[model samples]
Target: MLSEPTFSFTNFQQDAVKALLSSTGISLLAILPILILIVRQCGSAHPAPPRGCRRLGLPPGHSNLHDEFDPKYSKGTSKDVDDKGQPLWRVKALFTHPIKSCAAVELNVADVVSTGFAFDRQFCFAEQFTPDQASTSEEKTQPYWDARTLRNGHYSRLALIRPEIWVPDPAAPDYAPDLDEVRSKGVMVMYYPRPAGRGLSSYLVKLGIALRLLPRELSFSVPLVPPPDRASAYPPVPVKIWKDTPVAYDYGQHLPQSLREFLAPPDAGASRPLTLFRVDPTHHRQVFRNAPRKEELGFQPVTGFADAYPLHILNIASVHDVAARCARDIPRLSVRRFRANIIVQGPEAYAEDHWKRILIRPTGAKSDADAGVEVHVACRTMRCRLPNVDPATGIRHASEPDRTLKSYRRIDPGDPTNACLGMQCVPSVQEFVIRVGDTVSLLETGEHCYIKLLKPGEIVEGV
Candidate 1:
């Protein structure tokens, strides 16, 4: 009876405290070895490589070996330009068909998902006859070694000159003309014709014969159609996007208005307009009136314009500014020579000069948060002598009244040098789809950049 006497509350509390102390003691004993092992491992571990080594592969104590291979150009940083307490505005557009001039599609929004545009100069017209700089053959095909050798100065006459046989047909299922017929007709027409000494009149006459093969008398269209499904037989080609609008090719100072007007839909019931011809705006200066002496033409000269590539880029702002200045004098100065693919509306005049890259999306694209396009800012478009030529009078001079070329002192000031800020993309048939209202995000790739249209200048030591 005494042993069973009672398990009171005090007894129960003592028993519980003893059990807890025993469990904690066992747990600590088991964890001590593990904790010591972890500490030892951590202390003996090697340190990670420096950040520069991880990124640029320049390890410490090996600077001299890599100095010779270091990049000399300036890579632009990512920053936004602010204006008047408001977020700065940026614009981006795509210019496809690099080789074929006067055919561009505008993208409001585009996805710069790759290094190059989707459809970049996929098609180009090669003259049937090759030019023999060594021979006296009137029709000589220039060598196609690289883009550097294809100087605009060497082919300046081709600007307003059209392919006598090769004409684009807008009405055709594909915009390109029938090459077989173009070749046949072009050969027949030009075989007996002699090369003209001054203007491009003879080239135009031959081009008319080529236009007969195309719908609406147009000349050519790029043959970059996508295949049905994913067929193995098809070539692995870049994706492309085509625009109905004609691309403009600037040959020095000649504005091919005939080509622009020809691309336009027939007005009411008028005959199909000629696709390739010249437009001379009377208000501007004539830069090439005295076509460089025969000797100067052989050695390519710079236009003193700064462009990433050889061609000039024209946006709405630049064109509008020119129009406003000439409104009193010429009232009809259109943006013809500044052949650019994208025509942006926002930003002040020449604002694209400061951009590094641009982003865009096509018109009516789906509203997916991740669905937009981007384009890297390769170069700034600079003014050139093309604007100095008075299209109306066909007069060429460095000083012309009411000339917009004066606005760009860097280009027209003293002697005409090819100093411009525009970017020149390589001529390829890579195609890309772009649209209006697309956001352009610019990023500088490098500082010591060269224009695509012209060859790089001799690398001289610090000026």
Candidate 2:
């Protein structure tokens, strides 16, 4: 038998303490400070884990656990306004959807572009359809498809497909990425639930993933930026979106077979083949809704593939107000269902309804007027049943939020039949980076009537 030796100071310390107490005639109260100091120095028998490690279920330095209000993002101080002392609203959140109707990528900072956010609505899935009888020879060789999104309940499953934007890290100070390199090197990785049939093999696959022996989800990657050479070979084709037919590059040849099968599975009863498309930069489709202010704004704003306007801005408080009116059985609502690019806080519920023009600037700037980038609140975003779909679970609600919103939110003059939830916006000419916690100032407020105008031959391809 092996014996282990243990060290103890009990006897020696007790004898020493007795000798000291007797010789010095010191009371327990007199030595209390000394005893406390010794215990503190010795610490516990076992050292504790780091503060971050003590958290349950989350790894250290997780992005969700990170503090967006940290002083570093605001240049040492979190001043909401400049020297003017004007009241301002803070940017609550920033989101970019690299692919339309798919999951959004939450960002601490986002790059502003002429149309919208740098990567917002840059890619979309389309369903191939037959061309019109007036199509020319070129149309015969190349066919255009209709843009498919979560607006249609049949394709609501798209919300489950999570996309991660992988791009080159922006340099310091300005923190602007090289546009060309960002497009060339950028990749959008999408992950979805396993689409394969359930059987012995499927069970084994799921078991393997559970044990960390296999990849958790099925995934595919698409280039964030289309290569010029490949784009040229495809030739720009027209894709339909609502009332507009914008020319775009169809990357059907580049998409993987597995992704295609997953999107339109044989058992799912899909009517059309889903394909990927990127907006053609040269083909301009001006925002007809902004025509009233085009001359006053100097340039007409455009969009890549958004339904109407370039940017969609939502007020967090407004979403909460709508959710509050829902029935008790409904799940807790999230702001993500609305899918807005810039989400602002500090404003009253539905306060954006009267906003005409707004300015977004850094935390503390010298001038309030000229420091921030001006964004025009074009019109009210008409509500649709799309919001009925839950983003996290990709499950469609019977009718809670959309039903609640329509009951009291029929406020838009242009589209009085439908309810309004958010504001559609058009940004300024110059590009800028919008960081979370930046200040938002209401520049102008006025009545707005939503409008959708289609030119004579705008919807036809090769007109």
For lDDT, the strongest prediction is: 2
Please write out the lDDT profile of model 1 over residues 146-223, one tens digit for every residue.
111012222222233222212233444433334432322211011111232223433433433353311222233211
In candidate 2 the C-alpha lDDT for residue 362 amounts to 81
Global CA lDDT computed for model 2: 0.70
- lDDT (10s digit) by residue, model 2, range 73-133: 2222222443565434778778888788988877777888877887788788888765542
Worst 10 residues of 2 by lDDT: 49-58
**Candidate 1: count of backbone clashes, pairs at least 3 residues apart or interchain:** 110
What lDDT score goes with residue 7 in model 2?
A: 63
TM-score for each prediction? 0.37, 0.73
| C-alpha lDDT of all candidate models, in order | 0.33, 0.70
